[model samples]
Target: MDIEDLHSWPDSVEEAEALQERLRDRVREEPGPAVVRTVAGLDVAYGSHSDEAVAAAVVVLDAATLRVVESAVAVERPSFPYVPGLFAFRELPALLSALRKLRATPDLLVCDGHGRAHFRRFGLACHLGLLTGLPAVGVGKTFLVGEHVEPGRERGSFTDLVHEGEVVGRTLRTQTGVKPVYVSVGHRVDLDTATRHVLALSPSYRLPETTRQSDRLSRAALRERESDPASAPPPAAAPRGR
Candidate 1:
């Protein structure tokens, strides 16, 4: 897979906000791959310390079989503040590195974050899709900046996630008697298609396999890094801030 670099990585909130405004237009509200063969899940696990570091994991799976086709992990230090909406700057660098290592190009990227359902309308999924030029969608466990009535306790039930008079996403019930997950379009994908793919990927669980597997892989990667003699610090070590 080819990785397109971010135009700029701004560490400050002001600059990052400016960058989001400049790049938000790049997101296309269209359908993704017609014949979905592969999908990749992305997640970043942070260290215990504020400025310690992070490990990004990309796990690609066969859309039909839901089996992993490829997996990669990258570790790197933070580059931006741990702001609510700007964590992308800290994670994107390492996530892109892992994506570049993949032998198979993914048809879609499923992010464990928000997309258009953000205050700036450009969350991690939106930012990642802009940088990689890939079809992406965000499936979040909690509401970011949206309000909606509770969906029915049945699989496939959904309601509009409206924010500031715009339906930015959907609250989808992937499993019966379980909490709903938020779905939003990232890039090169429409809200309907994004919801469909997320449901297809999550046949039995509240969260899709993509997110679950990526979560496990990323956490494992971070733990492995923490145990390495070269990476670990003394017990009396203090947290590092940005």
Candidate 2:
């Protein structure tokens, strides 16, 4: 899977914000693949002992069976500082590296972050979808920049997540009697379609298999990097301006 070099990496928070503003216009909120054969989950894990150290994981699964098809991980230091709305700048590079290592090109991407629901409407999932030219959805554990009425407890129930009086996403209940997840369109996918995909991916667990598996793999990769001296991360860079 090849990622498009859409823009240069931003070095400062101002630059990151500007980039997001420019690229946000390119995100297409339309129907994606009519028949998704495979789906990939993406996540990143940070080392507890070192703020700079992080691991990104991508797990591809057969959509019909929910069986693992391919996976990859990349361990590296964050290239940017931790800014509230500029989180993608810190993780995108590492996640792209991990994505490039995958042998399979997934039909859809499920990111553990917000997309159109973001403050700037360009979260990790949107950035990744634009770069990869793949249909993507963001299934966040918490709300980023939206307000929604509590959805019904039944699985498949959802309500519009509105930000600034615009329908940006959905607060979805993926499991009966479990906490809901936030779902948003990343790229080339509509909110209804994205919500359906998320529910299908999460049959039993509160989170979809794609997120659960990738999260576990990312943590494992970080643990392995931490235990091996040869794989130690470089000296942490000074925090950049916000």
Candidate 1 C-alpha lDDT tens digits along 112-141: 998999889999899888777889999999
Off by over 4 Å in 1: 232-242
Q: Following a full C-alpha superposition, what root-mean-square deviation does model 2 have from the true structure?
A: 3.1
The digit string of per-residue lDDT tens for model 2 on 1-242 reads 77776877677788889999999999999976779999999999988843568788999999999999999998878878788878877777778878888877999999999899999999989998999999999999999897999999999999999999999999999999999999999999999899999999999999999999999999999988888888876553322221
How many Å off is the CA of 70 in candidate 1?
0.4
Best by lDDT: 2
Error at 26, model 1, angstroms? 1.4
Query: Candidate 1 overall Cα lDDT vs. reference?
Result: 0.86
